[model samples]
Target: MLKGRPLQYFGTCIALLNMLGMGWPSPFLPVLERDPLTSITKDEGSWIATTYLIAGPVGSIIAGIALNKIGRKRSLLLSALPFLTSWIIIAITQRLGFLLLARFIAGIGGGAIYSVLPIYISELVDPPIRGFLISVMGTLTIVASLFINILGYYVNITYSSLICTLPSVVFLLFFPFIPETPNYYIVNGKIDVARKVLSQVRGRQIDAEEIQELVESNEKGLAKAGVLDLFKIASNRKGLFVCLGTMGAQQLAGIVPIIFYTQTIFEKAAADFPVIASTSLLYVLLIVFSAVSSAIVDRLGRRPLLITSISCCCVALLMEGVNLYLKSQGGLNSIGLSWMTLGDLSFLVIGYSIGLLVLPSVFLSELFPLNVKGLAVGFCNIYFSVVAAAVSKLFQITSDHYGLHVPFFVFSASSFLSLVFAVIVVPETKNKSLEQIQIDLRNKDEHNKGEQTHLLKKYCSEQ
Candidate 1:
């Protein structure tokens, strides 16, 4: 619709491929354990599903350092190197250790991509379509995950992995032609380049007033932020809290484990059913509902969407926990409710994809000022990997020791906590420019301080 919107859409291609490689192990875990050339134990198979997170923090740190030094386009190009190598390794690896090593390498690329891409896209697009564009990127990642699930079911793991490498190859070949962000050029004092790139993106020449506004915005953001600045500044501190809370809630609710172990969950819940088909259908719902969210996010706003999503997830998880509990106790079959596993999982997919899946990235891109955004979002992604790894392992341990219902119940409770957090803490960021968001964060903090002082003075006079 816009001048450079096609290229913006193409920019999301790497993200799609990133998730494709990241989610490769989800449906193939059981197959890998049974393959004679790369046989692994149940415990080792779990490692294959989660070891991508091991190197994620390191990659995020690298992305944080590179965002300013190398710029967004080059950082993305650097990330593609690891992605290409990892997928190639997976395609030919005969040893289980090699397979796990490949996954860790992919995690490195994934971490960098997650940290950099959101900030890049936010800076590139206009405010009117910013939410839609970002949400579309999230949707494409979901589509990639779904594609891997179906591909693993129909094709061999080696062949599927080799196919996954194509996205990286395409990105390397095409992405270099795209322009860097206007913000990055302005900050670096490349005014002519910034103007040319901005006009190209906007389909018009830059006017004097807009150019002055852009200069002033860049000037405000030019102050370099240290790690302490994240917590030392009140607005930055609040932004970090909001981001971590959303990411933590999503991870703790077992969304990562659910996506990574979809076939495993279905087999454990209902062995006789067609697990792959059910899993594929579940991901289809994710893609469909995530698209719906992309279409409506700017109109409905962030706060309401998050509230509705968490509420739906809480109910769905509770239902899933109850269904598993009944099935585990040997009563589910007698009552003719075996289909409830698929039902509950479909509910979870709808709930997660609509809001929880996409909003975390949106918050990361919108909340913090440019000065702290790269560092704050980098740390946020690092924290996301840690929680995801812990929760994924915890899901396996609890399900094996106690029952599948135990983890489901725990996740249900976690969703309730997340719901409370969303309602109480998350801010509305719809239809606001990046600079406007920074101003609002400061204004809200100052307003709260003024209210506290007035209440204190009132109490003193009354006493």
Candidate 2:
């Protein structure tokens, strides 16, 4: 563990709490749909699940701007307001529209927290365990999400939602004790405060040399930043492409359908255990796998774990597609249930839990330059929110018109393609600094440019 880890972990819990609040509605959607208590239609039920995504991008954009203007801790503290207020809305509202509105509001907060958390954690921890702690953020979200899923599984909707809000309330209160990110302070011209923060977080005095290095990096970052800088700067442009691929793949990896349709799949297969129990089991594994991932990511490197996990995901989704296709055509036989179907899902859940779930946000935190970190995170969230919304809605439409196999096949194909993109585009950060990553990206681009120039000259001379 790094120095001042307990305080750092407290800050990271805010990220977990935010995501836990987001997960409350997933497992209980069944109750809201058919329990006769809420009694929402199929269509209305689907909308309730997706409205979070639609509003997420909006929250992320606001968080990005606020991250720069107000500072990370306060921006994060403010982000909790929407999620807490949202649970209150859920407890009070019986109207379907109001329910959707509440989810949307919470999604907004999630967007901000999701966008800002990686940045906050990255700055809080040193390089040795930076990836590990960032991965911890990922595991914590799974833990939080699964806890809410289990809570919502047993409890009534209003009480479950009210229970979920408590984390955010606790976060809002406890976070003031933690200081702002030194990177944020440095960037905002709070040099003395940045020094103190760095000392406090590291539990040792930051030497003049290290402080100077940080200040110089921020100066360079500020000089290069602008409205179109994300696209205009060569290093940032490459970072953007890589971030998009990783973030998009994570968001669109059919995870929503995997978790969202867990009960549906179990019901169709006539699984022995209740959907709640099976879902709980897989989610428990998700936490376990994520913890293992956090423990090992610093040593194993990001690319291998991602490639391996996603490869497993690709195969599992394909197997799932085949099984669904065969079952729909009556080519499959069942004795109360199909073990193969559940087995395929277990593989998929384990794969996603370990790599795809944890790494993309870590990549987002590490890959971008500090000046563009917030903007890059914001952009990825907005993009991911749109993709998430599409996949959520598409899962139903494709399942209805095209059959469940269609969406499964589509997801399988996306996973395979994303795996290839990751192999080629994503770099191994390992224990490298953000400045080091920028330099490496710049050099790689220059190498490519040199080859292109040579090829052009050779062709021109031949002509």
Candidate 3:
């Protein structure tokens, strides 16, 4: 089906692998802790998840720097090396230290790929189908989780790690065939090359107007930009704020912890239910709704989907908290309500997969101008890394001391706050060209500034 546009499929393959690597702990941690050979304590097992995130900021910074100097394609290609190395180490290592080192190395590659891949996809696809193409990454991520869960259940850690390395190897061998994005060429003073790339990707000769728009946008602000430049312009500032807020909402809502510890959560709530079966079913629901979100994102627009998605998360998480609280108090079994935990979690996955899981990265890739997109994405990804790590640790600590209900309540509160933020602040970038989005951001910023100035003048006159 993607033969007509192999770029879309190939470009996102590495993301599937990235998510698989990031989610490796979900199924493997419990197995590792139980194994006599590993001797992993609970605290040490927690770091198995956290260490991957701890190394993310370094990778984000490296990608941000390399994106301009080496081009997006080269930077992405470079990311595969760490993944390849990490999995190899995982396949052979029996020591806990090597496992952590391997996970940290994998995290570096994952961070770099996350920071750069979405931007690359956004630039390559047409605006009409951009949301669908980009949101496919979400679906692939769910697929990765599901795949790893099944694989880990059937195989030992060594075999699982060795199997995971195949995606990275495939990426290394195939991704080079795809051309660099026209935006990269345009910004780098290669207009003729940009035109050819644009033509090739679109499967036709590039029109003059499209080429002219690229030139004009490049002339306006697609020059080389540093991190500080992200704040100096009103549009860039707004874009950065939006991207950061989106990321904050996504991470703070507890997706990372839930993903990292899905089996643990299931085991805690419904010990009788088959953990692997339930987790696999949960991932299946996620894959289904993620595909639904991708199909309708362009038609429905981002704001509505996000508003609905976050609202569902809030309600589902609140229900889950109540269910866990009742279970902790020994009230659920007598009332025959043990099934509520699975049902409530299913609801939460439905909510998260539909919007919260998919849209933040889409916003990151869409909101910024070409000049500062790479740097802005890097910064947002670093913020993502920090929040994800903190949330993961917070979930573990709070659950240990205060019961799982406490962390669920906290996550529910964060989801409510994020819903408010989405309704009030997040802008719709659906069906808009990249250059047009930049212009709209500028115009919207100027309009707000004008209103503020007018109010200030009126206040002075009254005084």
RMSD in Å for all candidates: 2.0, 2.1, 2.1
> Can you write out model 3's per-residue Cα lDDT over 337-428, one digit (the tens) per residue?
44687788889889998898889888988988777877888898899999999999999999999998998899899889998889888899
TM-score of each: 0.95, 0.95, 0.95
Stretches of candidate 3 exceeding 4 Å from the true structure: 1-22, 207-209
**What's the TM for model 3?**
0.95
CA lDDT for candidate 2 = 0.82
Candidate 1 lDDT over residue span 1-463, tens digit each: 3357665565555444444445564657777778887778989987876788877887899998898888987988888888888888888874888888888888899899888888888888888778887877678777878877778778887899888887788777777777788888776778888888888787788976887788886565778779999999999999999999999887776777876776666766654667667767887898999999999999999889988988888898899888888887886772244477778788888988889889999889888776777899789999999988899899999989999889889999999999999999999999999899988988999999999999999999999
Tell me the whole-model lDDT of each prediction, alpha carbons only: 0.82, 0.82, 0.82
How well does candidate 3 score on lDDT at residue 280?
79
- lDDT, model 3: 0.82
State each candidate's clash count: 0, 0, 0
Candidate 2 minimal-lDDT segment of 10 residues: 15-24
lDDT over C-alpha atoms for residue 11 of model 2: 60
lDDT of 2 by residue, 244-349 (tens): 9987788667987668878777666667666677788778888898899998899999999998888988999999889888888887776423677778888898
